[model samples]
Each structure stands twice: as C-alpha cells, then as structure tokens.
Target: MKTKDKIMIFFLTIITFGTIWIYWNSKKKNNKKNELSRSEKISFDINDLILFLGDINNIQNVENTHKKVKIYIKDSNLVKTEEIQKLKGISSTLVSSEYVNIIVGNVAEFLKEELSRKMEK
Candidate 1:
C-alpha cells in the first residue's frame, strides 16, 4: 500500500477509536447520573427537602402561603406518612390517586432563597 493511503487509514482508525471512547464514557456518566437521581428521589433532610421544593413537578399544588412546603407523591401507598411527619414541624395528609401531600412548616422561604442562590451560581 502507498504511504499516503496508510497514513489516511491510521487517522481514520484513531478518529473511530476516539469517538467510541467518548461515547462509552458519556454513557457511563449518564448511567451514574440516573443512579444518583434515583437514589435521591426521596430525601428526608433539610438540603434535599429544599431542592425538592424547588422542583415544580414534585409539587402538585399549593394552598395557603407560609414557611411550609407541600410535597405530593404518587407513590404514597408505599410511603409512610408517620416518617415524613417526624421531620420537625411537618404534617402529612392522604390525598386521592395514591397521593400523599406533606406539609412542612417554617422552611419555605429558606428553601426558595437557597434555590435561587444555587440557580445564580
């Protein structure tokens, strides 16, 4: 084979390998992200609760304004309201469609502030 043809083949091989490497690395990262998100679906801490409050999807609706944050879950059947109620001044109410709405008092403003600050960053 000609020198030019060999060099072209070598470049093509390198490009193909580079593309495959990048694709595999990105796939691994996506899996990790998925796992992390799944593990973070339900959090019982101050920080995670704040992040959950910032998410509009996790919230079904809001009634009465105050420091309380309301969270409605579709998997309420599997969730224990007692555990959720144990969080400081939180209260839980069972709603329709396997949904449970949890009310957490005296922390809405704090969560919003933290969410906004994080968004700016």
Candidate 2:
C-alpha cells in the first residue's frame, strides 16, 4: 500500500483499539463501584406504620396497634418465618408460605419502586 494509505490505516486501527480499551475499562470501573458501595437504608413513618430496609434486612414493617406491635416480613417469594424471625426487627412473624401481595398496604407504593430500582443495580 502507499505510505499515506498505510499511515492512515494505522491511525484508524489505533483509534479503534483505544476506544475499545476505554469503553471496557469504564464499564469495569462502574461495575466495581457498584459492588463496593452498599445499599442505602431508608426509613419512613406514616400514621402508625414504620418501614425499614438494609442489606441484612430485606424489607420489613412494624405495625403498632392499640395494644400490640406486629412485625411482617415482606418478599416476592415465600420464605420460612424461622429464618426471617432470626433477623433483627422481626420479633415475631406469622411465617408466610405465599409471596407478598403487592396490593397489600404493608409496603408503600413509592418505597417498593425504589427497592426494585436498587435490586436491579
């Protein structure tokens, strides 16, 4: 090939490789950052209901009634109460074999969306 054509091809090849290297390294760095950062805990109270969630704590609630405070472990899949009760904040769980109902009032709508976003990451 002519010297000018050869030089142009070399520059193009270098540019392509450099771009690929930069893209791959950027993606790896972003993934590493996500792995290193922990999920943030969120808390909010409306009326007599309380909500709390963390890495160790999936999703839970403490409902205050006239005379009793009840705990509920909420999840999309059925989980043993014994395993859930073992976690802090879940004093006594009814132990459900059914997946949590999204329509249920235990989890507020906005918080559920936020949790879903976090889990996606």
Instruction: Give Cα-based local distance difference scores for all models.
Output: 0.50, 0.43
- Could you give candidate 1's per-residue lDDT for residues 1-121 as a string of tens digits? 9999999999999999999999999988877643211111223465544343443344444332353443444443444445555665556544445344455444454444444454454
What's the CA error at residue 72 for candidate 2, in Å? 29
At residue 100, candidate 1 shows an lDDT of 44
The sequence of per-residue lDDT tens digits that candidate 2 reaches over residues 16-98 is 99999999999888776442222223233321122222241444544333222333455534344344344432334443433
**Model 1: worst 10 consecutive residues (lDDT sum):** 34-43
RMSD to the true structure for each prediction, in A, is 15.0, 14.2
Clashing pairs in 1: none
Task: List the candidates' TM-scores in order.
Answer: 0.33, 0.29
